[model samples]
Target: MGKGGKACDASTQNRAAWLHGVNDLRIQPYPLPPLGPTDVRVRMKAVGICGSDVHYLKTMSCGDYKVKEPMVIGHECAGIIEEVGSEITSLVPGDRVALEPGQGCWRCDRCKEGSYNLCPDMEFFATPPIHGSLADQIVHPGNLCFKLPDNVSLEEGAMCEPLSVGVYGCRRAKVGAETTVLIIGAGPIGLVTLLAARAFGAPRIVVADVDDHRLSVAKTLGADQVVKVSFNKEDVASEVEEIKKAMRKGIDVTLDCAGFEKTVSTAFGATRNGGKVCLIGMGHCNMNVPLTPAASREVDVLGVFRYKNTWPQCIEFISSGKIDVKPLITHRFGFSQEEVVEAFETSARGGNAIKVMFNL
Candidate 1:
């Protein structure tokens, strides 16, 4: 245990999966930090493997955040509250909750302005030095934890992380009944965005991807149309026309879940004049595209970085049955040493798996 009091009874084991180096993971005992006055200790029950987690396992780095030291690996998670600090009042022991991985410095201007996701001093779980929630227990802020409704499972609660991204993106793009949406990429993020757009009353949605299986998944998840595109740059213009033809209408909003330059270009070219293109995927650190053409057409390209206050809306969407995320979870593993390795591999391979989960 770390700080004021011991983490639960010292007798119980607190095992966690840690990433030591590239492609190396070890399950070992972890120390629970002493709870602060506003903290609550959570006993993790479910964790979902994210694409960024796989990136760290494969390269020991995710964008600018690198694993300079051994760190626990997970961010999408839900758990039962085991204990609450002296000043904690919103949660109690036995309360099932979804953990929001990012905690902002409330003192920052961005945080005060309700854009805490953009706070420069944010500490997100499983990023660099911050340990994640894929463990026996974790000490977290009560404010960052949200209580799940009676119908919501721990696994569904964990799904909220990805769903929050989709919800936030849709909100940012102002999708509505009059808008026709074009979603680029049929991966997990894209699929969630499709669900969110539909829930937000998008009249028509067309999804494009390089994989047939993923496109099929998008179709099953309420996408009005799915287009399988080629990897050839020379074929992009024709593909965009095909996509627009499939929609049978101009795209009022485009959500690029695949951050490749090719997808961004397709989005810019396919959207109607004065439409909005929101970029959610982080596939490329730097991308070069036709900015002048998009500008001339009045098409706006927006960038997304994680999410802000979206947990309650995500839970409501799940509980109300507006969006079902359970289908996205294709593989599940236990928290054993070998199982952890397999989970990471399945997520990294990314063939049929949309979301790989850990059943703790």
Candidate 2:
């Protein structure tokens, strides 16, 4: 909408936010990659900083994804299509869309089975060598880019990325009217899971978190009750009981968005026999917890690796007013050198800033 107008010029150079090292991000010009036949070039309009992005900026790695080189940083984004490749017919120039960050190798066994998120050859954005979409322009697969509905703004479209994770988690846990859900953690992901669970018709929802502010936000977003907890090991049992008491029913499904050993253990402890524990957080790679007891009770531990076939439902939830993600976006910044640094810092501080967004 600025320099490129409706379509980016062929010779136009794209400016991207690159993470060179820990706490180091720069706005620099980068050469655009060759667009494949089925790809579409998009001019980014909205980009939200994710927890993984903040982790990488703070520690130079997220889980096993280390920043070996200067990589563009961001995945939750929405943009206007600036150009379409030869074989791309689903989208055209000027289409506002939300991007699905991962593209799997179609030949993989996981892809064939419809769980492409597990594909070993998946080239996901902001994961190591894969460049992200926090730039002036990006070339992405047309199929992975879903056109936003008329009612959804570009910022709302970008929020779909995080919402998809919650939707996918709820779907996997099979939340329904008869189920009593206990969501551990009231961060952005936890709050979205609460909204998703309610949308999926979970009769009772109790959100547990250490922070009262976050818990209040969750309650405002339709959580039936909110319980405050701490990380103390001694508090785990009590917290579990508190969460269950708040729910006022046996926990049918526990979506652990904190992923700490304590949180995961509480999820297991609180869940009813033959219930589910969906671990959606990536707080720790390895955790020591009482898994034997939960498993012996037939309480299943479910893990989420991003999401699959979730954008359409996420968009529908937003467009149909079943979910409201705009309130989650508490902080906004412009796509500038100074603003980018400030925005990341605000997100990293992790107090009032739930979802930090960049208006590119």
Candidate 3:
């Protein structure tokens, strides 16, 4: 039994989840299990929708990841602790918290090696067969749930999930004071990457995107230069060349936040010899990059899955005022079950929306 209820039973609880095999999601009653001795019950306050969420909503799948059944579709979330397990010590009821969605089997070598993000036995929320935070409440491990500082809002805490990705990408690319970085996308992730890069002391930051509005937001977020690209442009190579020339000797690191063939090509072309290129977006499964040229130029191509060992640093960054995520949240929704579907729908069709947050 937890603080809010007697015990987990076969009884149904009202929850709003996105069921697959259909295009739209709905609110309905679902069953919740009782909290275990190591689990903490959380009353979900805010959940942010990622681009992956939209992909699931529109296509019901992302690459090889598919939804086989009804699943709650929110991984970026923050909440208040409603109940603590018998064995939990560091957290208790009413504590504002941020959730690290992936729970890896601690006994595995990958988990022991501090790369839990690569743990084969991990179960991540919002992933297929693993229901996520779109519900009213959820049970998670106390260790995976981090306590929020007094100054950080539940919305900023919810944003840590995606921001962690940016931090991980920067860490992988080794971005620093001498790095001249080119970020090839102006979406949420790209913008966050820009912020993280700036925080990492990158000397120059260049951002490109098809959307002018998103590019403007990137500029506001601290991008040194913003380039607007069009799919119909006849000479993308020339435009990229001009941008590179304008950026002075070429970029030390190039990140493809827009995972398309064209953007990948631009990323490869934008980097200097012996530089690094990282692909952070999941727009395309197989991209035909300029591998031969990259090999000749000694360009290091890197990939990022989810982040590991980054939550603590991200939390500290936010707490210390190095990263301000408040402006990233352009829209907010209430915790009422009625607004769940609408919130997902709005996020699924992003235009003016940067980050959509739910308040409980």
Model 1 CA lDDT for position 87: 94
Off by over 4 Å in 2: 1-12
For all predicted structures, in order, the TM-scores are 0.97, 0.96, 0.94
Q: Candidate 1 regions off by >4 Å?
A: 1-12
lDDT scores for all predictions?
A: 0.91, 0.90, 0.83
Query: Residue 327's C-alpha lDDT in candidate 3?
Result: 88
Model 2 Cα RMSD, Å?
A: 3.7
RMSD of each: 2.4, 3.7, 3.1
**Residue 113 lDDT (model 1):** 96
Ranked by TM-score, the better of candidates 2 and 3 is 2
Against the correct fold, how does model 2 do in TM-score? Answer: 0.96
- Residue-level lDDT of model 1, residues 1-360, one tens digit each, is 232122443424788898899889999888776678989989999999998998889999989987887888899999999999899888989999999999888998999999999999888988877888889888899998999999999999999999999999999999999999999999899999999999999999999999999999999999999999987778789999999999998999999998988988899999999999999998887878888999999999898999998999999999999999999999999999899999999998899999999999
Single out the weakest 10-residue window by summed lDDT for candidate 2: 1-10
**Model 3 CA deviation exceeding 4 Å by range:** 1-11, 232-234, 336-338
lDDT of 2 by residue, 1-360 (tens): 111112334444779999998899999875676777988889999999999999999999888878888888999999999999899888989999999999998998899999999999888988977888899998888999999999999999999999999999999999988989999999999998998998899988999899999988998999989999998978988887777788887899999998998898899999999999999997877889999999899999899989999999999999999999999999999989999999999999999999999998
> Model 3: clashing residue pairs?
none
